[model samples]
Target: MFNISLRHSALPIALFVFTLMALTKMRPPNLWAHTQFLLSYDVGTVRRSLIGQGLAWVFESGLMQSTIFALAAVLTLSGAAAMVLFMARALARLDGGAEVLLVFVTSVGMVTFLCNTGYLEGALALVGVAALILPVRGALPLIAKCVLCIVGVLIHDIMLPTFALLVGLQLFLSRDELPVASRIALGALPVALTAAVLTALFLLSPDAAESYDTVFATVTDRALDFPTRKGAVEAVMSYGPGMEPAYDSVWGSDLYRFELIYISWIGVAITLWLLVAAARLISHRPMLDRLALVAAGLGPLSLLLVAFDVSRLLGVAILHAFLVIAVVLLIDESARVKLRSVFTQQAIVLLLIVNVVVGFRPLNGYPEFGDDFPGAVMELPLWWNMPPSGGRLTQNPGE
Candidate 1:
């Protein structure tokens, strides 16, 4: 039984259990404005591309149009399956206790934030991450990697930054295997590729840019719109003074506080983990390890560009955290052992129990309004905290 469990049931059993919990936590597609945007796609606007149009078509189907929960569950399960298969394959390629820890950490990370988030873009982000983490062996694999990068970007342009970060990490990790000049050239590839694709896409469909521009304007305008009567915006936007007002807003003060506490905790944890990983990499001082150290150090800088939005910042942070952990494990075997010791089997059991308990809440997003699954769940305890959603579909205070 022990051998059988270790060889077969360990990862699959855990993943299956988490998938069921995540399904219950899945929020209906219409709750958020971005999902709504995808749901309302039309030929007249450039707001959506292939993915959006596909989702809109699916949702428009007779029963699907009204059965919002079914749509959410399908997306969550499909994306979760894709991510689990990719990560399992990646972990299986390696051997030893390191494999055990990587499986645990990556699985927890995905269930907590990356996978089964019930958002189309979040699902695509996992696909992008899996494509990046997959081992490259030959020219064919490299070509596939590039294609996956393109697909991820086409799904959602925000992934462009993530693609660039992965490019930098890849170049660093493979530096010793290639020449100096080749490394320099590879460093520029992500930017050049992104530019070339954007230019081509614009030439093919200029209206996409127009649609995104309109969306950006709408997003910014809504953020700036505040309930001046109670100073809700000023309070939430402030990092220190007078935060209580927004925290007490009918829009859901508890949610705002939860987001602040959760994000801050994530930020601190990743920062500390990076430092510890860097120390290990510095000690051995292998070329590849050193390169990974530098990449980890520079990775957080990308968040500066998207700092205005909290969700985007957290999303980037989560991706960076995953990248840092993966690279450190590749270079330093000891780090994996350290992770296994700290995380512990009992701790994992507790986490799984917590996830199961939360699954009963029906407290998915928009709890300020009411629970869509009132008897089943109660709060948005998931890691992916979205920024205030608004657009043509939902009302922002000013709109």
Candidate 2:
């Protein structure tokens, strides 16, 4: 038996989600046409707090943001499982800490590859991380950091501010060899990147926002808000992507919703705990020793950071990952058996808890037949054994 503790791990977080979807139905469907029309247009202003607001105007709904809010919530849940890949790699490096940097490189690379099927915050956050860690080597590291920063910016322009700050760190404080003029020249890159981020956010956010509002409007129009229909709303939201899936073998038909407050608070609490732990280890241990502890700690922070806001989270997760790599080095490469042993246990227990808590319920819904064929477990980094399919989504003609 997996045990109650195991069941309550991250897995219950899914229940939290189901509960949220069930409890709050933002608005009705026909009134959603305006929002949906905007979604079809991919307009930017609508996403900038306008669409959600506008929809509320038509519906008198309160405080509910946009569809992105729901989507972000769903992704936030997915993000927890995503970090398992990073933690697994970090643990595997228990014997070789210095090279833990490479493990990070591999972990981020692999996670990003699997992330959102190739376009997720994990990819962007990982890029930001590479920005900070790659620079320990000065010039070589500087170049690497710049490349990563640029890459992160490209992945999600919102990440520019974070990377831009890092660019400042790498050029001014970290890279001793870079001359003044060269540093100045390099400094301009972040400025340019910042501009790019602003432009993109201004231009694209509206469309995303509008599309989401439309979805919310649609949900509302259907009066899916009723406690009775909550299950159906979650069904459409969780599994209804652009091109529905082929099976509903995950959580059966009774999908649940999450409460954002609970999700964020819990994530924040866990983040703070790890932060405190890592801080203690960093203060006590040697440079290498610190790396191990930090790596173990980074998993939660990265997840929390992204969970809050992609932009801020991207910057922080990047910085944390860099530090996590250093800590990994300290723990895995430590000459002291006692120290390494302590870290090994801490790392294992921490991650195991995380995995158990991030419930891996299958998303139950199909695009075509609505049959209950099992879906694949969310395999991070593409190598872990398959997770049991969690639930199902029956095909609906509504789309």
lDDT of 2 by residue, 8-62 (tens): 2332443343334323311122222212212211222322232334434654433
Off by over 4 Å in 2: 1-119, 125-135, 140-144, 158-257, 284-347, 360-399
True-structure RMSD for candidate 1: 10.2
Score residue 15 of candidate 2 by CA lDDT: 36
Clashing pairs in 1: 247-253, 360-376, 361-377, 361-378, 362-376, 362-377, 362-378, 363-377, 363-378, 363-379
Residue 3 CA displacement from its true place in model 1, Å: 16
State the TM-score for model 1: 0.58
lDDT of 2 at 225: 36
Q: Once superposed on the true structure, which residue ranges of model 1 sit more than 4 Å away at CA?
A: 1-9, 33-48, 55-71, 89-116, 133-135, 195-262, 271-275, 278-316, 327-363, 366-399
**lDDT of prediction 2:** 0.36
Top TM-score model = 1
Model 1, 75-182: lDDT tens per residue?
A: 556655554454454344233333343343343244334322344545455556656665544566566666666666565554556554565456555554777667
